[model samples]
Target: MLRIGSGAGFSGDRLEPAVELAEKGKLDYLVLECLAERTIALAQKRKKSDAAMGYDPLLEKRIRSLLPVLKQNNVRLITNMGAANPLGGAKKIIEIADELGLHVKVAAVTGDDVLPYILKKCDSLEFKPRLSENVSILSANAYMGASTIVPAIETGADVIITGRVADPSLFLAPMIHHFGWSTSDYELMGKGTVIGHLLECGGQLTGGFFADPGKKDVGGLAHLGFPLAEVQPDGSALLTKLPGTGGALTLRTVKEQLLYEVMDPSSYITPDVIADFTTVSLREDGNDRIVVTGGSGKERPSELKVSIGYDAGFLGEGEITYAGENAVGRAELAGAVIQERLQDCYEELTVDYIGITSAHRGSFSYEGIPYEVRLRVAGKTYEREKAKRIGEEVEALYTNGPAGGGGARKYLNEVIGIVSAMVPMDIVEAELQVMEVKPNGA
Candidate 1:
């Protein structure tokens, strides 16, 4: 059996839970799945501003927290913290190891960035209609798979950094490298992919995101521990978490996370293999332990999904609080005033009264009016200055329109929109490079 633990579910996950896993989970690999669909686009924008600023913002902190424990426990680490720049991320890891006076081998998998290829073959690629001829593309990256990571693992690297890849592929790569699973073994690949998906979210499988107050109560939430998977040679796994952690491990939580973000259980596609979740079965082995089995898959996809990001203009937002007897009415009036003032200034605008219609958008019924409400006005425009006016006009409403308006706040942000496309596998190649670090004084 191989034990792989999830260090993080996203870029900003808590560091303590990961530290617990490294020091106590007795893990073979600690994977930190950090990147998301929009994160890479944001990283690309930051990389444009500064050359060495594209990786996960907390990458250094995470490494600093886990390095000593990982080395002490002989646990390897894998992560998609590279974001837009894998080489830069690898170098940062090397520098951190040197500062800590620890010798470690770091590997970076690159070549996922396909912006140049997209530009050269823009008219030829199969993309969504939103990516029209006029749309200005900021970044284009093809989702790579586990194949590129095999060599990195073979190089005996203590840490592996990757760019955008299928979330499950990060976990599957280690299984393949350790167990020597054949690439064509779709059933085994599917089983491994299921383990990856279950562990990818870190705490989701262990009840971090499953609490529903009194209906579905979970304990120790403040110190919730991340999850780990004890996988077998056949790709089946026993899912559990560190003892005394804050969350529960049950079939209900596992089932909920299994279906998360999945459109069709029969045909879940990825860069590595097409997993079939419908065939999977789970059994409760013991307390906080569920034995997962029966996952299957088909051949890998011929064309990889490409995430393309473009400048989607600017977003300006402003909010003002209202209280007293007729707070709802006062909030409505405030929203209307902002709408009437900026009628023709924005391409799109929205007015929502928080604590009432903002969440459900009129889906749920509210019996009584609340004592306080926040009126929020937002607008979208191509020009930053025009967007700024949306907030400025709302700020003016404190003295100009509503009687009890207070706590007014406003800001403008540049929006980076994402679009998806299909690129042939042959066009995008994955490359791996290794770097070894020596003690700074040595």
Candidate 2:
């Protein structure tokens, strides 16, 4: 049996929960999945500015906090913290380990960035025509799977860093290496994939995102613990979190995570296998523990999903609050004022009344007016100055329009748009390199 714990779900996740898992979860491997579609795109922009700055911003902090305990417990670490540069991330980890006087082996799996290859083979590649036209490609990464990661694990690396791979593959790789599961073993691989999916989101399955107040009550969310999976050699798993922790691991929580981000539950495609979530079954084995089984799989997909990012435009946003006596009416008037002012400056504009029609977009009845309402104006433009003007016009509404309007806020940000395309698996290659760190003064 292997005990693998999820240390992080996204890039900005809290570190204390991971520390708790490493210290108390008795984990064989602690995997942190920090990269998201937008996160990697931003990382590519950062790497373009500085050669050594593409990985997760908190990579060093996470390592510095958890390295000692992980080393002491002999639990290996696996992560895709190497957002755009795996080698750079590996060097940073080695440097941190050296400073801590800890001898550690770090392995980095690379070759996921396939931008150059895609550009060269654009005419021959099997993807949409739109993928090649009308946009500057900032980053193009193919989602690698456990096959490339298994070699690093086999080398007994203390820490494994990867650039861009499927999130579940981070957890699945260790299971494959530990159990020697054959790639063609679709049923077992499917089971392992199910375990990976459940544990991949860190606290989502452990009740972090499952709270609904009066409906689905979860306690101690402030100190909510991450999740762990006790996976057997047969690929079946028992999902649970640390005892006395802040979150619950009930069947409802598990089911919610099971369907998260799943477009087609019958065919959840990945680089490794096509897992069928519809065939899966769950049963409560004990308190805060559910037995997972019946995850079957077919052959792996022929093409890998590629995340392509490009600069879309710039977004400008501004908000103002109106309170007391006809607040809704005043807020509506303020929104109209800003829209009228910036009609020609922006390509698109939106006027939302925060309290009345922001969420439903006027779908619900507006019979009862609220005591306070916030007026938000947002616009997008190719020109940065034009985008900034949207917020400037909204901020000017304080002196020129509406009574009792206060708490003005404005911001402008670059928009990085992401699109998904398919690349043949045979064209993209994955490689692993290992680096060993000695004591600091050695």
lDDT for model 1 comes to: 0.91
Q: Residue-wise lDDT of candidate 1 within 401-435, one digit each (tens)?
A: 87889998999999888888998899888898999
Superposed Cα deviation of residue 201, candidate 2 (Å): 0.9
Clashes of each: 0, 0
User: TM-scores of all models?
Assistant: 0.98, 0.97
Q: What shift in Å separates residue 424 of candidate 1 from its native position after superposition? A: 0.8
Per-residue CA lDDT of model 2 for 75-173, tens digit only, reads 899999999999999999999998899999999999999989867766665554365466677888999998989998989999999989998889899
In candidate 1, position 347 carries an lDDT of 70
RMSD of each: 1.2, 1.6
lDDT of each model, Cα atoms only?
0.91, 0.89
Model 1 CA lDDT for position 64: 95
Summing lDDT over every window of 10 consecutive residues in candidate 1, give the lowest-scoring window: 126-135
Point to the candidate with the largest TM-score: 1
Reference-based TM-score, model 1: 0.98
